[model samples]
Target: MSVLPDPGATRAVLIGTSHYDHLESLPAVSNNLTALAEALTGPTSWTLPQEHCTILSNPTTAEMTMAAVRAAAEQARDTVLIYFAGHGLVDPEGDLYLAMPQSKQRRVETGLPYRWIRQALLNGRADRCVVVLDCCYSGLALGTMGGPSDLADQAAVEGTFLLAAAAETRQALAPPDETCTAFTGELLDTLQTGIPNGPELIDFGALYRHLRIRLAAKGRPDPQARDRNTGARLALGRNLACLPTTATTPSADGEPATARSWPSPSGIRTVRGFFKSLADVRVTSGLTHQMVSQRSGGRISPGTVSRLLNRESLPKTWHTTAAFLSACGVPDQQVAEWYAVWTRLLTDTTTDAAPHTVPHPRQHQKPTTLQRLTGRLSRRNGRSRDHRSGSS
Candidate 1:
């Protein structure tokens, strides 16, 4: 339901560091910056003027800050997207810092504090801000609760949306032989080719979900996101892979062309019931684990499919569940319904950690997205308090 940002009123700044003086270099980052910049301004995307997009490759901390400042100075009224691909550093206190060519491990001053970037974006006039980070422990940008030194205080901005390549404790993968970093490579491909059966416009919400499923299927670190004030609803670009309506029209036989009927996960209240439902769906699909994985276009591994069905514990995240269902040919609308069911179960079982026990539903209705967000935020805030300090 999101609309594309006004092309003439938007600006993008892409920063990357491929060669590092004190840290291992990510040679693929250079490719990420170039390709991403082109894609953002390309015809298939926002089509912003070339001048509206800025690319900074292997820049110093000062240069990176200056570029952010200059982009902010543009005072874009619609949207401003800032992307960084390089080494992400964290101090012992668990503050996130972006590494530059001269950045050293555990040295906060040597790298660019994420706060500086956040401040710059907050200073801009843009109505919405999008931040994409592809690096080790990039999820730290989402925030932590470690006292004044913590990044939590700076986490929220009225219209900010963040997409991170990995969790706070995980390292983002950058396969050496690939042309681009693992996260950015998948991202760029998605932007260019678009998702099949996707909407006309590709929004951040869809983009984040796509990345999470694709990465998890490949056994890579899952991406994370935080959005405020519906920023995730901002459209990023057109969907090149959306099919024509005529192609989906019913055939002369009165049956819809290419119809697929998958089992519904409706009215399920217990973890055991959910697991049983998943088993039923798998059986109904009549596919081997390998076949399901293959149908997922390699987004879900055969082993992962096997474990998902066989494991007694309910899936902890919607990403895994949606990936499995989509691979089994479930429609998008049904997948969304499944998400609601998952959220209801998650909310009901929040106080009870034991997944095997069936908890009575707190309310006999599907939870709205806002309700789900509230529950998730509460849980994340709680976890942040107990989270241990670490560096990646």
Candidate 2:
């Protein structure tokens, strides 16, 4: 028996976090959070009311996440959906848990327990609760806690379904490119345009199959579904006959008929805001200084890092600027978009291929110590080659 309720009457609380104080994290989590929120709230004309959806993001901390989960569960009437995208680890006791900013990988015992989440669902007022865990080692928490058979039995009585990104021993892949996590990206892609409505309801079995196929297409490890209750299933309920199958098409005028576009100023602000957000994350993660030195191969100085962060100096070459952004995990598309917008503002045309050229006040000045050392090494290598050639 599964613990999912009538899907049509469900209220969702989607949360995504990516930045871990320690661990290899991706900016994709933040992007996925934004995308998921849009999918739920956007005027895609899903059969459900938009007012029932709630979304949250906490890339740096888990304190807010706990509060959001509790509040959503309390407020939910029929069904509660919780989606998490971040890091997961196990404690010495073999208990699985999600990692927080202050989480100590070594002392995993202190991390937030996965059982806490289970207990939340068990105690929550909602009739059906769905948990989507999109993180590496996610299955460890659910798999070690109990077998799918036990969960199915519980769900038959209480209604609960857990979807894990991978098996206990496998690792889930991050976004292949600039998209969200491979699993989440596919989920959204399917939800928006794939599923159709009517007599043929998108069953849990079908949905999982769709998600699995999409993830596998991206070369990701397949996700496993655990159904604990046999009689439990997701239904649209009375208020909603079926999840809206019609895709929202654009108007003839090239404007979204239902979806609202950000105002020009707001769009510009969002672009700039994203950059500032990345900068802030870099500082908090201590990756800014580390990235500059790492990409420069010890050529960049701490003082140069200070200047770049303070905006007192910019990278003199496109390669350096791109590398710096890459180190901070800013997607190339986003950088290109920003650059395109800037070019349009200056030239009144959106299409431009001219490369960005940095203007230095003292272009003829001698190269810095780092450049001089590299130049000398190059000359020495050339002379050695010449001598070798003459001897030969």
Best by lDDT: 1
TM-score of 1: 0.58
**Clashes within 3 Å, all models in order:** 1, 13
Candidate 1 Cα misplacement greater than 4 A, ranges: 137-156, 243-392
What 10-residue stretch in candidate 1 is worst by lDDT?
A: 141-150
lDDT of 1: 0.71
Q: Score each candidate by Cα lDDT.
A: 0.71, 0.52
What is the alpha-carbon lDDT for the whole of candidate 2? 0.52
Best-matching candidate per TM-score: 1
